[model samples]
Target: MNLPNQLTEREPIDPKLAVGSSLPNPKGLLAIVLALYLVNEEKDHLDYSDKSGNTIILKPSLITSLKAFFNGITGYNATEIDSLASANPLVEMQIEPLQVPLQLFWKIAKINILGTDSSSGERTGGVRFPKELFFTTNMDILKNVISNENGDITNTGKELIYSWLTNNNTPTSSVNIEQKLTKTLSVFSEETLFKTWNNSTEIIFQQEGIYNAFDTTNATVDIGGTKEIKGTLRNLKSSISKDIHPYLKISSSNVELKNPSLATQFDNYQKRVSNYLDLNPKSIEIKIVETEEEINVDDVTILNKIYYGAPGTGKSHKVNELLKGKEERTERVTFHPEYDYASFIGGFKPITEVDAESGKEEIKYKFVPQTFTNIYVDAWNNKDNEYYLVIEEINRGNCAEIFGDIFQLLDRNSDYSITPSNELKQYLVKELTSVDGIKGIENGKMKLPSNLNILATMNTSDQSLFPMDSAFKRRWDWEYIPINYEKSEENPSSHYQVVVSDSISFSWLEFIEKVNTIIKENPNLGMDKCIGNYFIKAKDNSITLEEFINKAIFYLWNDVFKDEDDHIFEENTFYEDFFPIATKGKEKVLKILEKIGLNTPEKED
Candidate 1:
């Protein structure tokens, strides 16, 4: 039996029949494979029945092919097969043939495993490639069968089970594993997932099957959602032992820890599994659940709010935090000087389209919907769900020019609906009216859907770029993100520290606070151009002196006090310490701030 090259000579096998060693059911197949070897050794027969009462029979012709294939791949003679199986045994290989999709057969030149769905060729559940065929098969042929596909998972339940076997590439800790399991279980009902994992693990023939700790009765502690996986891991660790260490050993089947040698075997298995998981991190399967949160559109008060603040005040971060889990419904766009009506709203744009018959690319103009219009249609389609269109640096673009006719949409009536103009109506009718769930259009006028929410962020410094009129400003509820030094320092997550030469390293939080204090005190340089804590972040809780001079000092010298009184720059208390570094070009500038000192906190002795 000669093997064909799977890569170049691509071939398709009968999908209905279990071809190749793609063992979809690893636990069951492992039992069947082990049983085949054991039965052949003890009784010299190829007959067995699994827990499902499926009879497995191995044919001599298939066995001969497997023998040759094994010798060809492993370079072992037929006589050495048993010894090969005993030493360095294939206990659990991740890329099981049965678990892989049928379409993946094209990936490997259609190498087929001969086995019963239960055994060999008995046809209990249908014709399946036997376990002996899998044991003798090339391991490389079975690798990455589930992964390397750019499509949706056809069998999500099987993929989750596979994740349990492989542990999602990070086996040392159950963090990534549990995350995958939690994400996978999110798709099914809490009850269904719990039941599936519970029932999937059953010792077949009482002697043949392999089961995992994740499939155990104790592992089914949580099927709630992604949030509950951490608790589930804790339950598993605590429930297993009174005193669980960082690395607790979960034993393999029939492995007793009565002696040190037996305990060592369990540890080895754990290490091997962990290493395999680290290598194949992508193997963990998860499904992002739609409609994770339930939000009522009517209850929303601030329908149009602009988060206004100084640069690096975390206005965008605040918006993300507000819509943390509901990211599917939100779309973001950064506005700039070039942003205009055509880019902000739907317009006819030249796009290249390939002519299918001619096989040529042709330039044509089509009505392309922009961020706002696209979100509008999507919100209308999903009326029950609230949608957000986040505009970053809203002040950078000319609001009047960019908004154009759609600016009227901002004017909401008592019920929070806007009447569109005749021109806007023609465009909406042509582009959106026919779309699913797009209602409320009447007499060439339209209303903003109740579910659609517009969120924008603006930097106070960039407010001069496109000064919004009073009417436009009136429409939006302004939320100010103030620069609070105390609040910045209080955040335990930000471990940002600055270590300056010739001075004690101070908290980045403290440095920004001191700078902002001086800026506030100066009449000419007020709050408008004050430095925020987020302006200069420390890399690994450490900032270089050069970086401090470049970012923190440069900003104050350039932008903050550019047009302000030179006396403000000459403040001895504020500008002294930075002058020695600021000397090369500006003699007058350095003379002014030569004695400017920053009240950085002294390091504790």
Candidate 2:
């Protein structure tokens, strides 16, 4: 069977909680996040309206603003970001404060803005933070909200935070942020402090933001080692003042403990707290490692996701790593209604055997191993590892009939089921001649061994076939394979160097785009035949190129039209209002064929 080339093949992946694939597009992200929330809330309709009556659908403006905010704080603490909402909350959630590492997100936003030049007053490196974050300004109102009726900017900076949110909807420009200030600056009106003020660093209220709430206690600190062995960490409230407390860090190796100058106090406090609490050390690797037997279904290469897709795709190349030229150990079977249990499972056969009474060879019943029985029984007796059964053109036969009772055995999820009652029981009990080259088991049923995998190839292009049954379809994971054509190394500018190659190179995306435009301009064409599967059987480079040319000619003629011997290579028969039929009329077909610049030269191969 000819298999088309596939464009992408993901490396073997472990099926743990790998970060989910990125949403297809930005809009898809919004939809998925919304869908998750709505599902969680059990709401029949989504609540698009904000606390205010205004709807807040994902908009280009909002997305742009968000991107800016993320880029602004490129280097910040990760633990500081624990409050952000996520698609899966429980997985990323951390109950303890020390477990929060603040450095993770700092790098993300930093990367976004690195080397980027900004047009607006935003993107300034200083803490003033990309100005896009402060797009909305009702600062005074917010101050007033947290402080009941207190309009004084100097006295009410902290108190007015609560009232601002209650009075209006969630402020659009980076409104939701909550963190106890490690260091605060005083706020003052010109009239209040010095009475006459040009801007000065002098403060009206010296106590503002000057408080540290959590203090340090005891620690288990090391003198010098990269790996932190043991440590004590604590979040203590200062007896003198709540804001003056420190966070302690502890470790067996003090080398890793070295950091920014201000880290000394927090580090010492963390060391004390960890030992006092008998806590685990810092820096835990987060990769989820799974045991072999408990391996996730994704991680296990069942080899079932056969690369079947749009034409020109590379399905065979994907298996090149395993099947380049090596002899195959897999059992390949073609299913047809004519296939019987005798060919699938072991069957009782009458053969000549020596009988002592007759002193001559006599017919006796013996079991003959079938394809399914061979591989399965081999693994049962000898654990020589993996066994495979690849069925090509899987749907060509009545699968349910040909497969009979074995479909359930091959199912991905079915581990154990009662022995199928019918002509299969005795055959299922039959043993194979070779068990991975070892002797076989006499009474074992034909069980699908743990390491056995099944690969079935199907072509959706086939018009005649029963729709794949639900029981059969539900178990297989589907992967859409795309085309990846082999490009030639010839140069066209110099005819001498331009060695003509078969199947001219074309970008799938570009081709699809062109087709879309043609469909829009001329509605009469049916997409089904518009070169849906454009593959050429290349006997050699020359023959291959000819086959490609013929395919193009047929596609141009038959796809956008019907039979048209009279069609010119440059005529226009398409009408503005006429929708294209599956097969175009002779005249229109000829016109389109000519329009598309197609021709087929007779070739002797």
lDDT of 2 by residue, 408-444 (tens): 7656544444454434455444434344322222333
- Against the true structure, what is each candidate's TM-score? 0.46, 0.37
C-alpha lDDT values of all predictions: 0.47, 0.33
**Reference-based TM-score, model 1:** 0.46
Q: Which candidate achieves the best TM-score against the true structure?
A: 1
Error of 1 at 48 (Å): 31
Decoy 2 TM-score against native: 0.37
Candidate 2 wrongly placed segments (more than 4 Å)? 1-300, 320-328, 336-342, 346-366, 421-447, 485-534, 539-594, 597-605
Go through the candidates in order and give the C-alpha RMSD of each one to the true structure: 19.6, 26.7
